[model samples]
Target: KIKRMKNLPMAALDSETVTVVKRKVKTKKKKVKTERKKRKSKENTSLKGKSEPKDKKIQVLQKNENNSENVESMKIGNGHDIEEKVNEGKRSKEFESGHDFEVELPNKKQKSSFRKGNDVEKSGEVSTGTVLKKKKKKKNKNAEQNSELENIAQKKIVGIKDKMNAKIIQATLNTKYKEEKLKTALKKSWSSNGYPLKIDTCDEDSGIKLMKRLPPLYYAPIFFNFYNLIDSPSKRISMFYFIYLFQFKQTTDLKNASTPSLSALRNFLYGPFRKYLMNITGIELDNTVDMGSSLYEQTDVLLCHDDELEGRRIAYILYLVPPWDEKDGGTLDVFHTDKNGQPADIAKSFFPVWNSFAFFEVSPVSFHQVSEVLAKKKRLSINGWYHGSPVNRPPKFVELPRPVKSPCHIEQEDLYSWINHVYLDPWTQKEIKTKFQKDSQIELEQFLAEDKYEALLEAIKLKDLKWHYEGPANKRHYEVTKANKAGELVRECLKFLRSEAVFLIFSQLTGLRLHKLAPPDSEDEEEKSSEKEPSPCVSQEIRRVSHGSYTLVHDDDPVGSQYALDAMLFLGVSEKWTQALGGFTSYIARDEDEELLTVLPRSNSLSMVYRDKETLKFTKHVNTSVKDLLEEEQQFYEVNCTYYE
Candidate 1:
C-alpha cells in the first residue's frame, strides 16, 4: 500500500521539495550576510589608524598568512596545513568576537575612530617587558659567575697576606735581636781593660819600666832563669841576634866594646818571664847571630844597614790567651807612627776564645814588652813582619878570601843520581849495581844518564847535599800522587798532599834565619824528644858525612851553581819515577805507625815495608800484619789515584 501511495504523490512531493529548497537558500543568504558583517566589524576594530595605514595592515596580514603557510610547510604532522588554517580561522573569529561594536569613520578628511595612544602604550609595554626579562637573565648569570670568582679570590688572598705579614714580623724581631746583641758586645769590649798598654802612660820614661829594657824585657824578671839563653837545644837557630843588640843599645854599650861577648848577652837574656814580655810587647829580641864563627855573623844584614838601629821595622804580634785561663796574660804589642809620624806604641790583648783578633801598626819607636808569665802553662802566639817592599839588595853571602867548597854538592849529586836511578829502574839489577858502585866510571855513567848532566858534574865537584834525606820513608808519597792526577782532579787527593809537602819542604829549606825557625831551648828539647832517643841534631850531624854542606864554592861556575843543577836533575828524575810507578801508597798501621805498600810494575804484587813513626825508618816487613792497618790508609792510595785520574 505504501509503495502505491509513494508513486501517486509525485506532484505533491515536487511542490514540497521546491519549498524546502527556497527556505535553504534564504538561510544561506542570511549566513553570508552575518559572516560579512562580522568580518567588517573585525577589520574596523583591528585596523585602527594607529596600528598602521590600511594598505600596510593588509600587507602585514598577507605576510602573516605567508609566514603561517611557511611554518606549516616545515611541520611534519599530518594535516598540518589544515590545522594551521583552522587555527587561523579560529583566531580571526576570536578577533572579530572581541570587537563588541563596529568602529565608525567621521569622514574621509577626519581620522578613523581609533586611539593611537592606547595601542602604542600596549606595544611599548610588551616590548619593555621582554627587554627587562632578557636583561634580568643576563645580569643574574654575570652576577653568579662574578660572585663565585670573588669567593675563590678572597680565600687565596687571606692565606697569602697572612703569610706575608708573619714573615715580616719574624724578620723585624730577628733584626731587633741581632742589633741588640751587637750593641751589647761592642759595649763590653770597649769598656774592658784587658789590653796591656795604658794610653795615659804612653809618655813615661823607657828606662823606668823594666818591660822596656831589652836585657830584661819581660815583666817579673826574677821568676825566669837567665842561664838558658846561651845554651840552645834546637838544631836551627834564627838570625834575630842582630836585632837584640840594637834593642839593647840604649841599655848597654856593647857595640863600642872591643870584643862583644854575645854569649854573655845570650846568657843574660834567658828568662822564663820572656813569655810575659811576648804577651805585653811585640818585640821578639834574641841573640841569634851571636854564635862564634856562625855564618850569620859573616853575612851582612841586607834590609837595615845601620849598626845602631835594631828591632823589626814592621812587625805583627799575635797573642792567644786560653779561655780557661784569663790570668795567663797574652797580649800583643805593636809599634805605630804617632800623629807626628814618630814611633808610637800600641797594644791589644786577646782572650783565648775562638775568633779573637788584635791588630795594630808597627814602627821603630813602638817598643813594647810583655808582662811576666804568672801561669804555669805556656802561652801560644804567632809573630811576623811586613816589609815595605821586597828587599832591593841581593842576600849577602859570608865574606871570605876565596869561596869555600860546599861539602853538600858532591854527596847530593851522587845520592840524588843513585836514588833517581833506583827509583826509575827499580827492577833493573844492572843499573842499580852500576849506580851504587864506588868507581868513578860508574859515577860518571850515572851523571851522564841524568837530565842535567853538566849540573850534576858541577854539583859533584862542589859537594852541596848537606840536608838531603836518603831513606825511602823520607820520600813524599803525597807529592807523587798529586803529580799523577794533575789534569782533571787538580784539587783532589793530590791537592792535600801537595799542600802538606810544600809546607814540609819550606820548613826544611828555609834555613833558621827567621824567629819562627829559632833553635829549641833546653825546655823545648826536653818537651819535644824522649830521654832514651838520640838527639835529632846529632843524627843530622852523622847524616852530614854522607850528604855534605850546601855552601857555595869558588870553583863553581857563576852561570849556574852545581847545587842548583843537581837539584834540577833530582827533581826531574823524581817526577819521572813517580809517574812510571803509578804514584805512591801510604798506610797507617793499627799500632798508630805508618807503613808503605809499594806496587811492583807488571807483577801487580805489593811489597810491604814497616816505617818507624819517630825516625821515619823503613824496614822489610816481618811481624807486621796488614789487617791491623787503618782502612783509610789501606785504601786511600788506590781510591785517590783512580778518582784523580
Candidate 2:
C-alpha cells in the first residue's frame, strides 16, 4: 500500500508542471543531437572544400585579428584610433579581393579616423560628440573673422561712393554758374549795340549832338559838376539821378539842382534803379551771405569772354546795386590764372554802402562777375569806361584818375596788389602796351639800366627774388601791334618761359623788369591760394600761376637765408649767374658733394664779377657748374623740367 502511495504522489502531480518538465528535457536532448549533427555536417563540408574554406576562414580571422591589433595599438586621441581601425578594415578588404590597393585617404578623413577609437568609452578616446564640438568652435571663429573683414570692405566702398557723389555735386554747381555767366554776358553785348536806342543816335555825331543839348552844370564845373550831383552825399539824389534827369525842365536846371537826401536816394536806388539795371543787364546780382567780415557788402556780376571779340574794344556800362543785407551776395568775380595756366575764379565784393567804385582794365582776361546780394539793400554806383575818341579830338582818357585818400584804400591796396601780382605789374603793363603797339619788341636795354632791374637781378642771384616774368619764345622778338592783338598772348608767353633757364638767367642777369614776376596777394579771401596758409615749420606763399606752374613767395622775415636757398631750388636758376654777381657770394653744400655760390649782382657797379672763396679776389666771371645749379634747384627742375622736357 505504501509503494502504491508513492506512485500515486508522482501521478497526482499538476498536469502543467509535468508537461513543462518533459518539454524542457526533450528540448535539451534535441539540441544536443542537433549540435552533434551540425558539427558532423560542418566537418564533412570542410573536408569537401578544404582549401577554399580554409583560405577564406584564414583571411577573415586575419582581418579580425588585425582589426583587434590596430584597436589595441592605437593611442587614445580625437579620431586617431578610429582612423587606424578603418584603415585596417580597408587593408583586409583589399587582401580578401586579392588586389593591392595604394589608395590615399583624404587628410580630413585621416584625421577624423585617427581621433575615434573602436571602444570609444573604454579607450577614453575622443567621441563624435567632442569632435563635433571642436569643429563647431573652429567654424564659429572663422565666421566671426570673415564677418569683420566684410564690414571693413563695405565701409571702404561706402566712403568711395560718398566722395564720388560730392564731386558730382560740385561739378553740377560749377556748370550752373557757367550757364548764368554766359547768358548775362550775351545780354550785355547785345544791349551795348544800342538796340533800345534810336538807330540814328548810334552815330558818333548824333550821340555828341544829344550830349551837347543837355543842361549846363552850375553847382560844379560843367563836367565835374555833373559828377558832384551824381556823387552827392545824399542817398536820394544818387538813387534818383536818372529820374531827376528825365524830369528836369531845362539844361541849366542841373546847375542849381540840390542833392537829394541820402536815405531817399538809398531807398530809390534799392527799390527801382537796382531792379531796372538787373533787368537790363540780365545779370542776377546777389549778395554773399557767408562773408566773415563786415568791411564790404559782396555783389556778383558774371561775364563771358568769347573769342568772337576778335581784338576789338567793346564798351558797356555797369550799374552797382548794393544789397539790403551787408553780408548778402556782393562778390565781384575776376578771371585770373589757375594752377594750369587756365582762367580761374578770382572774385571780390565791394561794400553796399555809399560811394564805392571798382574799375579794372578791360580785356578778354578781365573777367568780372558780381556776387549775390544778401542785405536786400540797393547799391549805387555808375559804371563807364573811357573810349578813345576820333583823331580830331584830344587824347581819350583811358582810365579815371584814382581818388586820393579813399576810405576803401585798404581794399584798393589789396586789389592793386592782386592786379600787380597776377596781371598788370609795371613790367606787365609796359609789356602789354608795347606788344599791342605795331611792331613793338621788348627792348632788353630799356629796363637794364633801371635801379629796380639791377636790384631784381641781384636778388635773383642771391635766390632772394620773389617774382620774374615767364614769357613765350619770340615774345621779346615779336612786335605786337594793336591790329594783331590777342588776349592770351601774355599768358601763352608766361607758360612758355616757365622752365626756360636761358630766359630766367637772362632776365636775372640783365635786370629787366623782374619785379613784375612777383605773385600777387589775392584780394578776395576765397581766391587765396591753398599754399598760402600757415603750416608746421613751413611758412611760405605758394602761388600756383597755372596748372603745373607754381611760385613760392617766402616770408623774408627770420629765415631769409633759408628762403633764398629755397628760391634757388624752386626757380632752377643757375648758380653761374650768382657767381657772376660779385662780393655777395655765399656757399651752400649739397648732398651730392656739390657746392653752389649765391651771389648778389648789384654789389659792384654795373659789372659781372665773381668773389673767389679761397682768395678774396673779385674775378670778371666765375665757373658755376650747371649740374650743381640744377641740383640746387631741384624743386624747379621737378616742376618745370620734368613737365616741359
Candidate 3:
C-alpha cells in the first residue's frame, strides 16, 4: 500500500501521482535560410574539457568503473540518523534487499533534539574515512580471481523478461517490425528532442540466449553490482557522480574491484551489445564502455542535466525494477532544450520497465532527468555510456550577470506599526541573533500573527484566480504566479518582505544586513543599462505557489553560487499540517555533500535559511498522497521569499 502524508496543514490528496507529460507531434526538419540556420554545435563540455585528438575512452571508463551511488545521496535514505529523528514516532525504517552499504539508520526513540529553530545540536560533517592512495600493484592476481568467478555462473535472470529479443518480442506480442530495429543506416533522432528513447527488444534471438549474454540481471541489482565488487563494501567510496544535476551524492564504485558479474558481462558489452547499439543508433564507438548500477528507494531522486561527460557517446540505462508505474518515479524524464541548448522543461517521461533498454546519444542538447521515486519499491538499474571519437568543439557560453533590485524604501512610521503589531520581543531577538551569527540559519514556528495569517490564507485561495505551471520541468513545477501576483489581502502579506519589522527580525536571526529587493524599475528609468553588482545587503522577492495537487521537483536554483537568504511562510491551512507529505526544504553543504538542515513548510511557520556562497538549497518534491478533501484544502501553498545577502 502507498504511504500517505497524513495530517498535513494542507491535507494530502489521494489522487494517483498522475503526470501529464506534454508530448508534441514530431516536427520534421524544416528548410531554413543559410543565414538563419545556426551551425551544428559541438561539445562545449560546459564545465569539463572535451575534443582532444586522442580517444580517452579506455582511460575515462577505467577511472569511472564500479561507482556506487548513495541512492538518497543526501536526500534521505534507509533511515539515516537524521531520518530517525525526523521520522520519529511516525514511520518505520525500510532496508535495501541485498546489502546495507549505507550508514546506520537513526534510532527513532531519541528525544527530538532539533525543530524549527536556530538552536540545533551541531552535528559533525560526514566523512567516508578511507583515504585514496596513488600507489599501484597486483593486477595479475585480481584477473585470476575474476576469471574463476566468471566460470562459476549463477542461474539465468532477466529484468523485464517478456520481451527478450526481436523474435520473442514478435512471438509474444505479434509486433511486426514496422521498420528494421537495428537498421545499418539508422541515425539517432535525439538531437531535436532531449526526450527518452526506448526499445522493447534488441532484435536478437531468444530469452535464453539474451539472458545468458547479460549479467546476473538480478532484481534491484545495485547492491550485487556495486557492493559485492568492492574490496570493502562497508567503507563507502567518497566520490560524487551526480545522477542528473539536481541530485548528487558520493557514489560507491568498483574502481578497485574485479568481480564475477563484471567479468561475465565484459565480453557481451565489448562485442554484441556494443555492435548492436551502434548499428541501431548509427553512432560509432570504440570498444570502451563505462557503466554501473544506481539504486534508489523512496525519497531518492535524480534531477536534470545534459549528460555532457568527456568522451561519452551514448548515455543508456537498463532497468531491473519491480513492477512499477510513473508514480513509482525513477522514470526517465526527458526535457526540451532551448535553442541555446540549455534544458527548458520536461517533454516526456517513461516508467522503469523490467529488462527494458533506453538510451540516447549524448549531445549538446541531450537533457533529461529522473523524477523522485515515491513508491515503496526499489529502482535498481545499471547506466553506462558508449565512448567513441569526440564530437566537434565550441566555445563556452557565459551567462550575463542579472542585476539585483535596489533596496525597497520603507516608511519609518509603518515600520514601527508592524514592529508593535507582530515582531518578536527584543530579549528573545538578541538570543536568536547570537545563534544566527554562529550557525548561519534560523527557523520561526508560527512566524506570522494568527489574524494576519488567516486573512492572507483566505485571500490566496480566491477561487476565480487561475494557477499555472511552468512546463518542460527542468525550470520548476510550482504555479506560474509568484506570490506577489496574489489578490490584495495576500499581497498585503508580501509587504512584510520589504517591511522593517521583518528586516529587524532577519537581522536578529541571520546577522546579515537585510535590505529589500527594490521594486523593479521601468526600462526607461535606467541610465545606460550596465551590470551593477548586487549589494552585500539583503534583497527580497515573494512567490505564492502550490504543488500539492500533483507530483513535482524543481531545479537546484540555477543561480546557486550567489549568497542569499530564502524564506518559506506557510499559509495556515490550519490543523492539517503533517511532515509525512513532505513539502519541505533542505540546505546542502557545498563542500561535503552533507545536508545541513531540513525544514517543513508547515502552516503558520516561517523557515528562513541563509545561503552562504558555498551552499545550495532545494524544496523537496511533493505530491498529493491522500484524497477526498474540500477543494480549498486539496493543495498546499507557500508564500516563498528570497533575500539576497
Candidate 4:
C-alpha cells in the first residue's frame, strides 16, 4: 500500500490536495473576516460623530476592499501556487501595519524567495524559513563591517591629534622660559663686576637647574701627545699647537647621544638659555652657539689664553665638579692686562666650586687659565661660546724695545778660557760648516770647557742674582737674569757668547755672514749704501726656564720673521731632563707646520741654527716635573742669543 501511494500519478492525488487546501483557506478566511469586521465597526463608530462621506467616495472604497479580498481568496485555493499566497499574505500584513502601498523588498530577499520557490515542492516549509534567515544574516554582516572600518579611521585620527598636542605643549614650555625669567641679581652682579662673575647654579633663580638634573654626559680623552711650538695646555688644539698632558675630553656640540634628557638639555641651552645670556651680558648675539661638556681629571691643565676668536661675544664655564679648594690646583686664574694688551698677572683667582658658573666677555684683556689638577677628583664642566658681532679689538700691543748689539773685539784668550778646546780646532770647524750647510742646523755636545761648565753650574745656585720674571704670558713666560746681576763666573760666560770672537766662530760653524763686515761682492756704491743702512746686530738674553714657561710664535714679533743665526748654550740642566719634560726649542716653517729642528736641553751643549725668513721658533712649555727641581733649589739655565745677517 505504501509503494502504491509513493508511485501515484499527479492527477490521482489532486482531489486529496484540493481538500487540504480548502480547509487551510477556510481557516485564513475566518481570521481575516473577523479582523475586517472589527475594523468596519470601529470606522462606523468614528463616523457617527461626524458627517457621512459622499455616496461616490463610499462606493469606490468598498469596490477596492472587495477586489483585494477576492484576489487573496483565489491565491489561497491554488495549492500549486502556495508560495504566491504567502507573498500576498505578507503584503496584507504590511497594509494592516499602516502602510498604504505595496512595500518593496530587498533584492537579496526577492532572489532568495525565487530560489526557495523552486525547492518548495521537495523541501516545503524548511526552504522558506532558511531563505528569510539568510537574508537577515547578510544584512547584519554588512552593517558590522562598515561599523568596524569607521572605528579604525576614527582611531587613526585620534592618534595624529595626540601627537600634535604633545608638540604644542613642548613648544609652549620652551617659550615660557625666556630672557625675562632670569633673576635680576645675576644681571646686577654682571653689571657691577664687568666680567668674571661667579654664579651659584644651585639657586632656583639661576635658571639652569635643568642641566644639573640631566644624566651624566660622555667624554673622550683629549690628550695631544706632541710638544707644541706656539700654544701649550690649550683647551683647543690646532695644526701646530698641542695641549700637553691636558687629560681632558670635550664635545664639539654636546650632542654625543640621542637620549631624551640630553636632547632636551641641548635644546634648552641653544634656545632659551642663549637669550638669557644676551640679556645679562647686554651683548647682541645671534642664534649661533658652540657648546660642549668637558672632563678634567688629575694633572690636567689649561694654559693662559685671551679667549679671542672671531664673532665670539661671551665665553662661559659651568662647573659641575666636586668639592674643591685652591690647593686642589684647578683654580681659574684671571690675568690683568698691562698698559699694552699683554696679560700681566692674575688679577683674581677663583677655585672651582660645585654647581658654580663663570662667564666673561671675550676680548683682548680676558686672559685666563685653569691651574693643574692636583687632587684626585674629577673636574667636570660645560664650556662654550656665544657668537654674534665681531669684537671691537684694541690695537696690537707693541713690545718693549729689545737690546741691540754690534760685533765688538774680544781677545782669543778670553774665548779659549770658556769654550771647549775641540770647537777651536780648524778641522772640526770645517766639518761643522759642511754639515750645517747641508742641514741648516747643528748641536755640539760638550761645547764648553769642562772646568768652566762645572763652575757656571755651581754659580747658578747663587741666590743673590736678580731675576726678572718675563711674560706677556701669551707670547713668552720665563725669568731673565742680566749679566750684571749674575756672579763673576756666570757673567764671563754670558759675555763670551755675545763677544766678537764667538760671533766669528758661529759664522765659521753655520756658514752664515754673521761676523762679515760688508756684503758679498760690494764693489758698487749701492752695496756700500746697504752697509750704512743697518749693521747685522745680535740680541741676547740669559733665560731661566722652569715650570710654567713657554714661548709661542706670533706674527707681531719682528725678530722671528727675520733670517738669523741662533746659538743657545744650555747650563745647569737637570741630568734627568728628557724631551717629555718639555722646555725644548722647536723651529718650524712659517707658512707650514713642518718641524725643521728640535733641540732638547743638554748640559754643556751648544745648539746653533741658521734659518730663513720663512721659519719661526718657540720654546716648549716646561711641564710640572720641573717644579720638583725647585724643591732641591736646582734651576735650568740657557744663554740664548740671536745673530742677524
Candidate achieving the largest lDDT: 4
lDDT of 1: 0.24
> Candidate 1 residues 324-404, lDDT tens each?
245543333323333432323333322333222222223323334332233444343323332232223323222222122
Inter-residue clash pairs, candidate 4:
none
Best by TM-score: 4
Best of the two (1, 2) by lDDT: 2
| Residue range with the least summed lDDT across 10 consecutive positions in model 4 | 92-101
- Residue 375, model 3: Cα distance from true site in angstroms: 5.0
For candidate 3, give the lDDT of residue 48. Answer: 19
lDDT per residue (tens digit) for residues 52-81 in model 3: 213211111111113321111111122111
Better of 2 and 3 by TM-score: 3
Model 4 TM-score? 0.62
Ranking by TM-score: 4, 3, 2, 1
Per-model TM-score versus the true fold: 0.17, 0.18, 0.55, 0.62
Better TM-score candidate (1, 3): 3
lDDT of each: 0.24, 0.26, 0.47, 0.59
